[model samples]
Target: MAKIEPANGLKSAESRKSLRGTTESLALTDGEGNPFGSDSELNAYTSERQTDKYGFIGGAQQYSEHSAENIPPEVLRQREAKWLDMLNNWDKWMAKRHKKMKLRCQKGIPPSLRGRVWLYLSGGKVKREQHKGKFEELDSQAGDPKWVDVIERDLHRQFPFHEMFVARGGHGQQDLYRVLKAYTLHRPEEGYCQAQAPIAAVLLMHMPAEDAFWGLVQICEKYLPGYYSAGLEAIQLDGEILFALLKRVSPLAHRHLKKHKMDPILYMTEWFMCAFSRTLPWVSVLRVWDMFLCEGVKIIFRVGLVLLKCMLGSQDKLKTCQGQYETMELLKTIDTRYMQEGFLVREILELPVSERDIEKEHLASVRRWKETRGELHCKSLPRMHGAKAIMAAEPPSRQDLRQNPTIIVESPLATKSNGEDKERKKTKEEKNGKKNSSPTPVAAYLEPSEPSPLLKDTALLGSNQSLSSTEHDTYL
Candidate 1:
């Protein structure tokens, strides 16, 4: 302003200063581009730097808009329900398939399912309660003297050689003792039998003590008739039945055995008697029990068939001298869990008759056999008594071996010397023809010498000689 001398740059020094102040003021603009009155004043306004024209927030906004326009809540609910139903139906289908497979398949039960399956099929649940109550009731009544003694005797003998269960104070032995004792108290009639130990041991695989006790009761009552009978008649009948089945399933092996005069009874008795304890692994035995509960007694036959079938293929490998040994070896070697489902199904599907019919026949046959034995007993009663009375009434004779005091030689050396002296005396007597006794020669007195060349040459000559040789040609 001092005449604002239209200075060189169109403004004087004062004008330039004013212009810079104006530009500075313009830099501090509000929303409407207005400058503040004071430089020290605080600004409280917010600025919108940049924004979309639509309410959408760029890429996210487009997706949000598309979803809001297209999706329905009811459709989502329907889809969720559809998937849930599919899962539920699939579970049901799987359950049914598993149950059927359990029944008809021959493979061993899955380890996870074994305990529950055994409990269900073996009537463990029902029998446990049944026997618990019944056993307590029977315990109050006096049991037969013979049965109590028998039970007591067998308690010590049960699983005598099984070291796993034989550790003095272990759980296995304790459980066994408890079950056997409980069963004895419960079933006064059957008491404790030798076979019960193996059966109990088997039951203990999948069950607690009380359940195993009841399972043993069920096995004794339903599956094995006459198993605990005094004379063991049922064991014989079962043997016969098992042999018959073996014959049907393996005729060639049967013929070979028959030709060799071998008895299946020799080895299979333990299998039939103990329910595969001696013949199968404990796990495999448990598997057999799994099928046994559902299929009844016939499972034994089927299992025996499978064993015999397995053995049939391998019979040629066995030496003829090992007939009984081979039969036992075969039983011991057979996989009890082989095609287990198929085996169970085949047996259940094709039993000789209804179980009820078999039960009836078995019982009737047992009764008849008992009656026949009773008749034989009655016929022989007088002779048995006469023999006993004759022995009792006769005066004590010199031949009364029991009355004669046994000479006890304290030392083994003395006993041996006495035996040698007696043998030498007997030999002298025999030479003198005092009696026609063949005395045992003194082994130590006999001198050792080289094997005779004459004997070796005679053996060789005998081998070389033809059957047509002269009658007088003695090789030695």
Candidate 2:
């Protein structure tokens, strides 16, 4: 049984005695024999002393153990310095490797590094200062009449339905137009070709107008041979190359294409024309462009191979669809970048040069089959005529049509219908004769009139006075 004692706050004579003790037997009592301290207080003091002793010993042991193993201040400082040096060396190594990579010219440079890397890759940086002055000089001169017409016709048509184009009031579109127009003025022989629009749009994604113009010049002159020639012979040759790559990368898919009488020229026309802008969404198109600007023309062939490989698995499903539906479905389902950056690269790097050449020959055989049939040539016509037919069906403004005589004559080609073409031409000639006989001057079309807000705000015109009689005739 536990003993209980009376509580008394008292001190002992020998030294100053505490009221709380570990053992009740050691408690000092007064002459009346009353207990001086309680057993509970004694037990509590014992418990507290035991805890304190254990805590002190534990702390001492921890300190002693840590002191032996812990690093010294000087040693820690040296280790930190050494680690920092290693990190700096790694950074230097990476910088040197990046410089060497630029020289080697293997893959596309990453997007963040595009501007500086492209300048270096194209040797445009060497002539950067000269380009601006040259561009300005070219801009002041009158451009070729054919190119001017082509540029004006396709200006609004470049990215008409794209949200990015519409949101900025076609600023990107205007920049693209200026560069292309300037380049056409600079190089009259190449002039303004159809494929320039898509290429210009891709340039607009990364660069300012001047830089993009020069970058395009590099692509046209150095990277791609004969790109902007009058008959687009260079473009046709590139299509041949892409077809050869597709066959080598995916033979089963290539065989399926031959079975369906599919010509690579049929599907890949947009790919070459727009650099996949019209064929792909904006994001994916930009990724391909990033690679394109870095790696030069080789990336395009690699990317084409990737596109074919992506479609290989789906060829069976695609063949089930009839006619145009199959082609459309195949294009829609294929994952373009994944196949290019992954599967095809792995396969291509492993093949020997002799084997690759043989595969290319096989593809050439398929291309020969397509060429003999005249199928490739037939497929290359502009797809815009279909939409132009819809636009022609809309009620024409009598005032607008009659105001410009040439508009009535040339507008029928927009419909692409044989019956309308002959009828419209005959009518146009008769109308022109009557107008010439009249006493009224042709300058009536050029009379000062308030331009619509849309037209007025556009970057197309330089000044109100620069709008000439020919310009009014063209616009009408």
lDDT per residue as tens, model 1, 1-476: 02222111113333233222222332343454333322233122112222222111112111222222222646544443432232223223223543443343234443323443454344444444333466445535455665555544444333332332323344655667667766766654455665677688656645555556666765766566555544444555555555555566667767666665555444455566677654443334545665666456666665665666556635464443365555545544454344333443455345453345445445564566576544211111111111112223332222221111111113344457758788788788889888735544332221111111121222212111111111111111
For residues 251-335, write the lDDT of model 2, one tens digit per residue: 7767666666665555555565555655543434544555455444554565566666666535565556455447545654455
Q: CA shift at 456, candidate 1, in angstroms? A: 80
List the pairs of residues colliding in candidate 1. 105-341, 105-342, 106-339, 106-340, 106-341, 106-342, 107-340, 135-186
TM per candidate comes to: 0.47, 0.49
**Cα RMSDs of all predictions?**
46.1, 36.3
lDDT of each: 0.45, 0.45
Model 1 TM-score, 2 decimals? 0.47
Best by TM-score: 2
